[model samples]
Target: MEASEPLSGTCHCGSVAFEVSRPAFMVACNCSICRRYAALWVHAPPASARIVEGEGQTDTYIWGDEQIEFHSCKSCRAVTHWTGVDGARWAVNMRMVDPADLEGLPVRHFDGADSWEFLD
Candidate 1:
């Protein structure tokens, strides 16, 4: 769970697996979709994350402007991560990450619904 340690996570059914460098912090967004899912997000470069398994066992959902595509595990229906349509940016669902790996990391609130800005 140290900052230097890498992070690996999977969906409830293990149909989706991925890894990211330990995040220094994460965001809790209040947008409608995020609020519904209650997802905590950890940002990472698209290249920094790799799908270790279940590439074909996942489903994508893109709505609104469709700038980002949310990915979930088809088997367990767990929201695992999302990526920009352009493949430029990405975010992992912190809920799927190990609790031990999130210790000491700040969770900032984001006003994604009204202002699309960080609240603190």
Candidate 2:
């Protein structure tokens, strides 16, 4: 893993702002919600992330497991990131990040499509 660098991201409406430190364990999952969201995720530890703006305009989506809460912008409904319970991490949506910030980063595939069986 590479050392962490603070990378900036925003909602499609530009109302929500976030910074995530890298050397993040970026993953591509094949689960339903993941597919619908079309996300590239960075599993960043809590210390590596910060919500810079629009906390009020951010809405939460709780899914089947509820172990993580997906966050989106209230206005544009752009998926931004998900946070793991217990302050463990910020599961960032790579689509919301600046393309330049993602330069030279490697993406790893995860079998979360079978997470219901494997993770259970």
**Residue 15 in model 1: lDDT:** 83
Residues 3-92 of candidate 2: C-alpha lDDT, one tens digit per residue: 555778898889998887875346777798888888988776533677799877778988887888898899999998888776666777
TM-score, prediction 2: 0.82
Off by over 4 Å in 1: none
Per-candidate count of clashing residue pairs (backbone under 3 Å): 0, 0
lDDT tens readout by residue for model 1, 1-120: 456667888999988998877766788999989999899888876226677888778799998899998999998999999888998888988898878777787889999999988998
Give me candidate 1's TM-score against the actual structure. 0.92
Compute the lDDT of residue 119 as modeled in candidate 2. 31
* TM-score of each model, paired residue for residue: 0.92, 0.82
Best by lDDT: 1
Compute the lDDT for candidate 1. 0.85
